[model samples]
Each structure stands twice: as structure tokens, then as C-alpha cells.
Target: MFQTEYEFTLPMGYIDADGNLHRDGVMRLATGADEIVPLKDPRVQSNPAYLIVILLSRVVIRLGALEMINPKVIESLFAADLAYLQDLYNRINGNGTRSLKLVCPHCQQGIEVELDQPGES
Candidate 1:
């Protein structure tokens, strides 16, 4: 079966107003509309970086116990967590890959390695 959603854990986690911490979450592949619609938003119009917040809110289906995920929620995330989500989004949305290519410092040989999220076994 084809998979469209991915699971992730924030590096620092999101803390709610009640002092609850949310670490685990789910993000789905982004659709064209997800990328396009946010462009029309005043926030995105004024600050292009705001696009990531809007874009993420649209694709992230779940986040711990939160009943809803929105741009405000995303804005509240720690910088590290927000970066994690961005990388995850790019990987699952066909904008990035799991493998990274590198050249050995000593041997000057090229090699490719697969990347694993922090907690994955």
C-alpha cells in the first residue's frame, strides 16, 4: 500500500497553555493546493517565510493531544522543532531524499548514506 502520512517527534516538543507537552505527530504529503493557497494569505504575502508555517499547518494531520493544528500553533514551536518539521516535510513531499552523498576526507571517495530520524531504531 502507498503511504501518504509520516510520523515524527519534535526535538524540543510543543507545550500547550496548560503546560502539556506534545512530541509525536503526523504529517502528510503536501498537495499543490497546500503550496498555492498559502501564497494568497496576507501573512505570507508580507513575509515569505511565513509560508512554511501556513504550509505546515495544512499538511500536519496530528500533533500529540492537540485538537487542531494551525499557523499559530506552528508559530509557537521551538526553532529546532520547526526545522525538524520542515525537513520532514521536504523529504516526504518529494522535495528531498533520505540519502545524502558525501566524499570521504581521507580517501576522497564518494559514498551515500541513509538518514534516520533521531529516535528511529
Candidate 2:
């Protein structure tokens, strides 16, 4: 058996007519659930986001499992899921414009620190 819980609030923003940010409002995201069954397939593990979002929709919206498994949801799932994946990729590829590791000169011990910019200490 597997179980997890998450709770957070999403702040709302607006877009101007020219597509600029408008700081305002607030929104809440919440979920409550009991037991969760784990997905046991190795192939699904490779791209687990699709399965994850389906599970989320089913549990959050109380929608039928079949509706959560529909094609349109899966399509939206990929794009929605890519945000985190892309952040991971950027961090790995050193494209994050920040570095979290530094080396000591004398002892050569690896020190972990975050650099604000490419050349920042």
C-alpha cells in the first residue's frame, strides 16, 4: 500500500492586453485521499507523468477512472508534465544559470553552494 498527501495554494495573476503580468488575486489547490495503489510496470516508470496525472484527476475530481484515461487528458498531461522534466534537464545540462557545487582549492573537498549567476560566488 502507498499513500501520500499534498496541499498548497496557487496565487492568481493576470495577463494584460499586451500580455504583461498583472499581480492580483489568489487561488487554492487542495486534495484529500486515502489509499493509493502503486503502478508496477517498468515501462510506465520510464514516463510516469501520464499515469500520475490520470491518477490525480481521478482522485481530485472524483471523475470515473475511464474519463481520466481519455486521450485528450493524456495529450494535455505531456505538456503539463514537461515543466518539471524540463527544469531537471536544465539543471543537469548546466543551463540553469546557477551552480550548486564548488571545490575547495587547498583540500580539494567538494563544497556545495548555490551561485546566483554564472560568475557569482
- Quick one: best lDDT, which candidate? 1
Instruction: Quote the positional error of residue 28 for candidate 2 in Å.
Output: 12
Q: How many collisions per candidate?
A: 0, 0
Clashing pairs in 1: none
Among the numbered candidates, top TM-score falls to: 1
- Candidate 2 total steric clashes: 0
RMSD of each: 4.9, 12.7
lDDT of every predicted structure (CA atoms): 0.91, 0.37
Tens-digit lDDT string for candidate 1 (1-121): 5677889999999999999999999998888999999999999999999999999999999999999999999999999999999988987776778789999999999999997543344
Question: Residue 39's C-alpha lDDT in candidate 2?
Answer: 50
User: What range of 10 consecutive residues in model 1 has the weakest lDDT sum?
Assistant: 112-121
User: lDDT per residue, candidate 2, 76-118, as tens digits?
Assistant: 4334343443343344334574656788999999988765532
Clashing pairs in 2: none
